[model samples]
Target: MPKKGTRIVCFSPKSSSKSNSVTKFSAPSRFGLSPKRPSFSQSVMDRTLELAKPVITKWNPETTTFAKVTSLFHESRGEAKDFIKCVHNLQKAMHLLVTENPTSDNLAVAQNLMQISMRRLQKEFYQILSMNRAHLDPESVSTRSSRTSIQSNSTSDYDDDDEDVDEVRVAGDSIVQVEDESSLAMADLKLIAECMISSGYAKECLKIYKIIRKSIIDEGIFRLGMEKFGSFSSHKNKKKNMDWEVLDMRTKNWLDAVKVAVKTLFNGERILCDHVFAVSESIRESCFTDISKEGALILFGFPEYVVRNSSKKVPPEKVFRMLDMYTAIANYWPEIESIFSFESSLPVKSQAITSLTKISEYVRTALAEFETAIQKDNSKSIVAGGGIHHLTIDSMNYLSLLADYSNILSPILADSPGDLPESSESPAPAISRRFAQLILSLLAKLDGEAKLYRDVSISYLFLANNHQYVVVKVCTSNLKYLLGDDWLSKQEFKVTQFAANYERLAWSHVIESLPENPAAILSPENARECFKRFNASFEQAHRKQSACVVPDCKLRDDIIKVNLLRKVLPVYREFYNKYRAKMGNERSIVRFTPEDVGRYLSDLLFGNVGSRSSSSSNQSSPHSRAPQSKTSF
Candidate 1:
């Protein structure tokens, strides 16, 4: 008899019955001689049929309950084992009969018996597969594959002694019993499949498997909420009709679906295919490709369809979703390659690569459009006090979020050449160059917006405010990593330069009103005229600056205020003390004491801080003046 799991090839019978050769045999000399003993081939055939017929007949689909709701393996493992053993023996018998009695009546009988046995195994194979749907589901099968590996490795570490064997068996028994049933079902299917394929019934066996399992995979993909993109009528029309909100939701669903499909759905089917057709590499590959190819194509094809069906004028906001899909494919590529490893599965692999390429293209296109949008911004409304522009806020916000995807975008940007210069100092050079270019475009646009301010000083303040806002945004987020310390330091220095320009333009004439040397002892007449010029310049500078605003507290207090005090205060104090006494009765010409100048400077740059009072009291006493005290100056 053939050993279990061995393939037995059936040979075609030779047509010996048609030969014209004649044989003559001498009649036995003794009349009482026993009739010619049965031929060895004849006895072998008789014994093989007797052993195979009863078991094969008992398990016949039409005659037994095995074809009904019962699983042969689950109903009685002994009978199942006996059935498989009989099929193997029947195949062996067929091989021998074909070789020994190629034209005998016994060969025909053995061939017919072999057919009956294979039919029985085929029915059992389909029945077990149908019955064990849940136990053999992809997720469960994937789990089983891992557990099986662990169990096999664990079993190998033990000695072959009976005590060690029993310990291993008991430990196995402690596992979830459902897995054991799944293992038994898989083993039985493998046995039947091997027997049928070895016996030349592979076509029938593969037909049944492909039909049943392919449906399961299709349904599995559908249940996971993957939609068929072809159902949409026209890619362009679909893109125009579908709003961003709907596409966004679908993209999210695809993200979820692809992970499960690769990790559990296609992967599980691959494992099951490899196990059932373990005896044939070609069959395993063919089966897996047939079972998983269509679904995987659809799964991987989703992102490309999304790119096609998205508006050609893709929204800047949608780039992240595109990157998300790209990252998902890139992240799970190894598993996809392993599961669909067959040469026949190249289309599925190609589809995945195409999707990644398409998504990267979409991201690059979206980024280019975003930069163009920033450059072409043409809002006419001026910011009230040369504060941060709305364009600046929006552009910085978009760039900051883009920085969050630096790792994903790095390779994508590297592949697409850009007009921007590369910075080796950056961690992700391609992304950093692109970000810097976009920022430059935004700053250029902001420069135009700053011109809307009537006061040159306020224009400087607007640039300073917006630049400081951009620097802060970069410093606080992932943009810091991509843009690097050098970029940040330069941006910060630009902010300081802007602030200095504002200070010079707004207050230069006021500081210049005082003498280059404040201790110069001018005659009383010259002192009074000097005091008059100094008071006029100081009040004009204060009233104008009071209306302007700075948004950042650190920029307003630490940088702007500190710089103003350092440059203007000490000089005014020395000029005031020497000149106030010389003014004599013309004390009103020294309208602002050194103390009053300090008080007014504190309120500058906070928008409209004292504008109304300064205007109303111009002819009256200076409203910002503290009570006169020689001790205060």
Candidate 2:
């Protein structure tokens, strides 16, 4: 009925005359009117289309269960299975139609049905993704992926040819089990994905997948409190002006978020993408990159932003947070590398590495700033009683806490040695060397603080107090391990040296006032004068030294007291006993017997002990004269 070269229009069963849906087929050859037997190939092609049409039309997006606002895969597994099987059959029919009967009228019908089927599958894919978001969440999907992998590996000994068939059969059988909804959803998605991709609608399938899954990831990151630092126009201004309390909270949140993002969020997406698009490596990588790359960049980029936007002088406390970020990235590098292994995902990897590099640089800079702070401390107020300087306590506390992170700082300091002095006495790790340098700088600052004291004896006491405190702090904490026993021993010796300096400056004049030889007899006037000089010097030294403090009992008893007793006690005792007899009734002029002198020395340097008043001294020696002049040391 149609002319040569004319086209015959084929419409879907649901199409009306007003519908634009139509497929065109060229008119068959005019010579085909001769009643000839159909070839075996033609019969097979016809049979293929006959078998595929009912399932294809039944599951069509317009007239079938797919049109309803329900997940086809979730509502009925049997129907979902039939739908996938129908698509496979339709693909076979298309292959046969193209090869055996390119111009057959039924070819146009098959083409039309195939398009409808793919649209339905696309809709179902989107619905499953949207409706089961919680089930398909990263944590759930990751767990299912692990379980699926174990099952696959356990049955791998089966023939490779049966693997695909077995996978489909297993997916169907598992749908009836009381499996978790996430596992069912995952298997259904994978099944539909393979079917659509094999049927040449990969673009449509991937588009819907990326749209839905990427949104889920973006929303998940939002819920996890990952902010997009790039959205701000002035990172430097934002960070510089931001309150540290707020920034610290954000940094802590970032730390928590990054772990979830990498280990669970991105990892699950990678698994789901791989499983769904298992037939094509390229598709899997591309899909996963599209779904997770932006979120990952924002997540990892937070640390870099914090570091880069920081004021030129980041607080020393900020270094600890920076180290936290650095340690996080370093600890999870294997996961990051594995998850973002694709070339397309390299930006994410680069962002994480850049964060690490920038954080390390900032940690080094912040530490250098901390050292400079110690070096530049200019407070002039001396600690009363020559106790430890405030600067010493603060610096040592900071260093001891810093030492807690030595495992983290070791590599960082090693990378940029800076101007940190290397110890020639022994080979120390870079962090140890840096710690040693920092402590030395603090000691130098304490030395400068020591000069603020007017009394030379008090200055020596100040140095001794601070140095002993430093040694105690180092020996008690992780610093002891970093700065080895040799260094510790050397520091301990320095403490002793300071203590000795204090002892000598405080008591040398008192010892000198006694006779060179206690047995050397002199004139009675010389005897009275010797007693006068001894009383003047001993009272002056005892009163002044008693006001000073030795906080550490060990240093007081073992070092300062021992050195003083060994140097002053025996000499003073001999002078007192020899002179007490010569002074006669004026023995009270001696003012202190050997017992009194030893007791006073024992009480020296305990800060709590008050100076002996003139009234109390006079009461002890009722007849002793008030000295004609005050002694100076």
Q: After superposition, how far is residue 123 of candidate 2 from its true place, in Å?
A: 2.1
Task: Kindly list the per-residue Cα lDDT of model 2 for residues 417-498, writing each as its tens digit.
Answer: 4222344465667888788888888888888888888899889889888899999999889999888887778778888888
**Candidate 1 lDDT:** 0.75
TM-score of each model, in listed order? 0.84, 0.81
- What local lDDT score does residue 412 receive in model 1, on the 0 to 100 scale? 87
Worst 10 residues of 2 by lDDT: 1-10
**What tens digits encode model 1's per-residue C-alpha lDDT throughout 527-629?**
7877788788877887677777888999998544588776677888888777677676655777777766776776666777645355344322344444454
**What is model 2's C-alpha RMSD?**
8.4
Best of the candidates, lDDT: 1
Residue 621, model 2: Cα distance from true site in angstroms: 13
The Cα local distance difference test for each model comes to 0.75, 0.73
Residue pairs clashing in model 1 are: none
